[model samples]
Target: MQTVNLGIVAHVDAGKTSLTERLLHATGVIDRLGSVDAGTTQTDTGEIERRRGITIRSAVVSFTVRDRQVNLLDTPGHSDFVAEVERALGVLDAAVLVLSAVEGVQPHSRRIMRVLRSLGLPTLIFVNKIDRAGARVDELVADVRRLLTPTVVPLGTVRAPGTPGASYRPHPRGYDQRLAEVLAEHDDDVLAALVDDLPLDGDRVDEALRAQVAAGQVHPLLFGSALSGAGVPELLDAVAALLPPSPPAESDPRARVFAIERDPSGERVAYLRAYGGQFRTRERVTAYRREPDGRTTATRGRITRLDVVGAATDRAALTAGHIARVVGLTGVRLGDQLGSPAGLDGRSHFPAPTLEAVVRPREASRTLALHAALLDIADTDPFLRTRVAPDGGTSVLLYGEVQREVLSSTLVETYGIEAEFGPGRLMHVERPTGTGTAVEIIGHGFFGTVGFRVEPGDGVDYRREVELGSLPLSFHTAIEEAARAALDQGCHGWPVTDIRITLTHSGYWSPITTAGHFRDLAPYVLMQALAEAGTRVFEPCRRFDVEVPADRLGPVTSYLSRLGARLDGTAAVPAGWRIAGVLPARLELEAQRRLPDLSSGEGLWSSTPGGDRPVSGEPPRRARTDGNPFDRVAYLRFLAQPPSRPVAVRDAGPERGHRSPR
Candidate 1:
């Protein structure tokens, strides 16, 4: 059977999870339908998700549609969980984007569509909730074309929409002139037939539609009510007929692990999607990960357990084009390409979280437990970076307020920890302002010596002026890792970014020097160099879009202006005026909360990460999570004591919050 990895994606509460349950039932994968409200959905098995009726993780479930074995990925709809959607995108062959007919095209809806188009994934737009009251199927198609892509072709129409009996009617063969025109935009045969006023062949049109859909040049739009099962059968048929199947698997073993979850026994389970070759249980496999230095590193691990999706038995082997739950790969992480680096880059698809808040344990006695729990949670969602200070203060990066709430609840429900969150703040970074160099000679306090020259660059560029083989690979790696870690806290205590550092000199006492010696010496020397170079702090900013009644534009703009937003342009949209601009991420929450009131609840607002800019005044400082490397006495004192467990290292390398080996 052909395999299809189809992702179900949408804005929050668009019935995406509902659609998954419906699909499973329609394909006889399940005996009864599971409701999101009742919290009985197959994919949303987490306690918090069931209680909150939300999807926090992207879930994979398998079912069959005729001869096709479909591995359906139900992704989180809330914008806070876009990271989950991004990971899912890396593994999917195609996608089914669900939109609510009642809500029409939402801001997140447009954002996801843009990402889909950018990735060139063959998509099937399913306009759902047609049976809900106030649903407008026909108008939504127009809205989709206007707000989303203009190349979408409506595959069918809705009958008795906005009612309980709402149903779908597939278009009759050769009846859609728009379909011909859409195809003709790229098809020479169709264009010739249309230009010459020649009769178009129905068979030709049907064939062209399938080919275009598979090529990601066109999207097939379908109407359905996942709640009532209206038009669901037709949607399933369209999925089988329209979307492309998995490409032929190559002979080389290539796969990517898109997600990681802990099983009931607390063992880590990695969701691996194989694109080629095969690996059996007990087989040793090499996982490949691209490092920050543009180099790929390989780690070998034996697969102790493997269960293929849709297999009747616990499949001992994973083949190409199939997803499997594999355990005992200690070195594997989400988005790690196994066997070969043949998949998409696992580096962040979206910008890092712009907002951060300090999390204080309500009872000071529980601080250590809270920190440990947060680190454990970060293992599953790497984007939820947790930072810890020497003073025991802890903070977490956030996407938005909704994610904040979910995380707070998760801590209480899962870890039984009560915590208070400080007001959100923009995550700022520092960049080197000039060139400076420093050197630490051997025997000053340790057996290793290191020197580094620091200056501005495109990103965290680590180079070596010293010869490659002058020291052992492990020692070199240790120095590089420590240099990057030291930059986590710059002169102003914010993480340093957009900087270049070259190791100018290195020395180690032949028998006495260890990797730890270089690790300890590298940070001290690098920070001193950074202090000499000086740095500038930049605050995160966001690109925003607002639509409100023209009459409300003045107040909206005024409110935005007060938030220090820089307006780029204002144009008249169908229902209102559209204003676009860049706003400080720190003020985004206030703007999001006030826009509805300013427009009498009709204002629509959306924003995306717009990079960062230098602060206008004295730069703000974050508490240093790394030992204060700039203070030589304090840092050496810190190194003398037993090292405390590090908090989850976000955007940092190798050591990613795991406890060091004894």
Candidate 2:
């Protein structure tokens, strides 16, 4: 049977979980429906999720639909948990974007659609909650077209019994004929049929619709009320009938680890979507992940166990077009390529977190335990960044107050350590002002002279383009890796971005200088190059859309302008104006607090991270590490430490973790 991986996603409280529950019930996967509020959800099996009535981790379940096996991944709805959604997307055959009929298209819903298009994932639009009071399927459909895509066409509409429009209907297989002209504009076959006067009934239109949706050229919008089960059956049928199918498997066995979880037995479980061939228990596979020093280390491990879509344990192999939970990869991480450990093309789509906090246990003795516990559970919410700062302080990046609370509660419940967080500070990054080089010799318990040239540009992480023959493969690899790791923090506290570096010299005795020497001191020399370049800090900015009463436009504009904002444009809305602009990310929170007062509670705002701009008021962030690379005494002082000490994590870029949802 053909298998399809479908993800259900939406903004917070848009009825994503409700939709998942209704799907399972409609498909008969469960005996009865589960409620998100009652913590009775099947996919939301995590304690944190059940208690909070939200999904923090992606959960998978399988059911057979129309001779096809469907592996449904329920993704977290809150933007705070977007990393969870990104991980889910990497393995999905297609996606379903759930939106509230009453609220229309929300800011997050639009952002998710944009991301879905960027990834080239075929999508189906479902306008949910049509039974709710004030639900306007027409307006919602229009918003989906305007904000998401022009090709979106409704399958059908929902109206209350005795109401003015079409009443609620189920199993309506016929395509709305009025939309055929629009379909003809995109589908050649449909246009050919129309031009030739070929008889086109619901069957012909159905064929056209299926072909278009499978090709991703057109998206069919369906109206539904998950709460009342008004359109649940049709939605299920549409999922089985409309979305694209997985491509034929390649000859070679291939898969990518998209999420990582640890079992209570201390076994490392990896969630992966197979792309080709099959993976069997006891099969040896190459694993790829960045070491703490930033090098892509390759290792081989035997698959100790394999669980494919909750199949029988006797099932020994997982074929292509399936999702599996396997154990025995000690080092695999989110986005790790399975076939070749040498592949570095694997990348994570999660955005950089914008807020950070220093977290410390109330009992100082539990510091190590706190770090270890946080690292383990941190995968539940990948954006909840837990990293050791350059100053040896442990910190976490959060989405907002809810995340901080969740982290604290989770830490206490899981790790048994009471913790508190320091005030949150907006994340900042710096770029080099100009080109600079470091060639001076500096050694710490090793012998070698390292140097690199630093230049500023667009890419976020470090890229090496050095002559391979200049050094041995291992030494060359270590230099590139160490140099990238060194950029974790510039001479300033903010993370650094958009830089190019190339190795210039490695002066040392080839036989005498160990690879460890290059890895350990490359950061020291790179810091020298960065200081020479004289960096400038860039503050985080956001692109915003603020909806306000038309008469109150002046008040909102004046308010945003004072917060160092530059208005991009403004459009008229039914009740107000949709003023769009760019502003510091910090100002967005303040606007949320003050806009209601200024607009007399009629303002709504949405924002996404924008490119950084030069700092206007804040000074350059201070470096926590010793500033001078040539200072041997201070450099050695920083390097000498206990064996258990975890080095400051390198700047190789973001890595996401998988969660068990505990």
Candidate 3:
């Protein structure tokens, strides 16, 4: 049987879980439909997700549709869970974007659609909850077109009768003309025949619609009321007929490591998608690592296991399909592309993290345990990187607050370590503001002299690149590392950004200084270079959208102003007014509390990292005068100019931590 790997994506509370339950029931994978409110949904099996009644992570389920094995990935709808959705899309052959017939297209739905388009995946739209009163199929379709592309057209509609807030029967084919119009648009020949008043065959039109959908030129919309299983069988038929089997790309022999997983047994498994060529068990594959010294090392590991979708009755693995837990490859690392003789370079899709914070165990004894646990988690998700800070802090790069929370929880639960997360701070970059010259004299009369300039560059905004040449490769690497170390902690104790450095020219002795000596001396010279160029701190700003009843708009706006949030505008939504704004991330927690009180429990809000903006005016002075530890000169000359130690954090007086909720 053929195999297909597909995913269902939608906004939060848009009936994704309901649709998933109905699909499972229709395919006979489950004897009964699970309820999301009851927290019995198969995909939302995580304890936290079940408790919260929302999907926190993506789940994969396997089932059969019309004799073809299918693997379905259900992704979270909340923006905070977008990382899971992004990762799931990488391995999917197709995607089903779910929309509520009443809510129409939401901001997150449009965002997910845009991501799918960028990934070039074949997409299908399912307008769910049609049986709900006030569900307008035509209006929602138009909204989808306005928000996303115009490729989607509804195939049919489901009708049920009731007032707004009441349930109705799942009636089929109540409106056939709309379905005919959509089907006719699938092909020019069909439209011509329709215009000529010629009869159209249902089977031929179905074939044409399937062809258009497979080609990605059209997105077929199917209506279904998952609550009552209305139009579910027709939706299943559409999925089986329109979605093509995973194409054979195993001939190319190169596999890209798109994801990594760790089984319950504590083994690391690299999830590979073979863009080309077949992989067999026990074959020796080469691995490459780009080191800090600008050199690449080649290693080898034997493939211990091989599996494919549709290989088992459970649909474990198949060609061009999703597979998991195929363990036994010992030496493979995350993002390593495996091939027969030559290996492929697997770089991450997003930029390396720019923000970092210290995560320390509540008890000092658990430091190593916490470090080991974080390392293991980092292997599965490469975006969150960890390194030891210069001040003996465990520095971790995070995507955002949600990721930070997950990491903290994992550290606590997996390793029995209680971790305290420090404040989120900006990760900065360093560059030369102008042309300058420096000389490095090392042991045994070895001298390496160079002219350098730091300037700004693109790619990762607010980062500076050091462009240098004329020095030996070893010396060049040493210089780069030295520059990075210098910028590791910026003047304001934040990482630098949007700067570039150029080693315009250099002179060096061949045997006088080895790479090691240069590496050691580079940090001191880079510090001087950084001092020559002024440094500044940049803070992160978040774009937020808050929804509240119209009556509470005035209070919502007032609260936003008090929190230093700039109101972009307000739009009328079905539930309330959507107040759009940009606010500093540090104030987010307080803002969340204020909004609920302002709207009296009737307000909702969501925010994402919109990128960084300058912290307006000069930042407030630090309460203490303890200088930053990252400064080399300050530490080297501590005797001449002593720095203050950190003050003890004392418990507040009786009156503190006792504020009443307003």
lDDT of the candidates, in the order given: 0.84, 0.75, 0.63
Give lDDT tens digits, candidate 3, residues 1-662: 67777889999888988889999898888998888888999888755567668886677677788867777878888765565675677667888998888887787887788777776677888877776776876677776775687767666655552223323222242324444466566577777777897766667666776776776767877777788777678777777888877777665455645455555666766666555545667667775653322235567787777655333433232234445444666666554556632443232333345557788888877777777777877766555667654343467887567667766776665667788888866554333334333444333223555444544543212222334445666677676666655455444444555556555444566667566555545544544444456554556677888889989999889989988988899888777788988988778778998777899899887665556656667542211111222233333343234222222112221122121111
| Candidate 1 lDDT over residue span 431-524, tens digit each | 9899988888887776887889999997788899999899999999999988887777888778888899999998889988999888888877
Give residue 420's error in model 1 in angstroms.
4.3
Window of ten residues with lowest summed lDDT in model 2: 653-662
- The TM-scores of all predictions, comma-separated, are 0.92, 0.89, 0.73
Q: Look at candidate 3 and tell me the lDDT of residue 661.
A: 13
User: Can you list the residue pairs that collide in candidate 1?
Assistant: none
How high is the lDDT of residue 518 in model 1?
Answer: 88
Maximum-TM-score candidate: 1
Model 3 lDDT, residue 361, Cα:
83
User: After best superposition, candidate 3 residue 350: deviation in angstroms?
Assistant: 7.3
Q: After superposition, how far is residue 638 of candidate 3 from its true place, in Å?
A: 11
Q: Which ten residues in a row have the lowest lDDT in candidate 1?
A: 653-662
After superposition on all CA atoms, what RMSD does each candidate show versus the true structure?
4.8, 6.2, 8.4
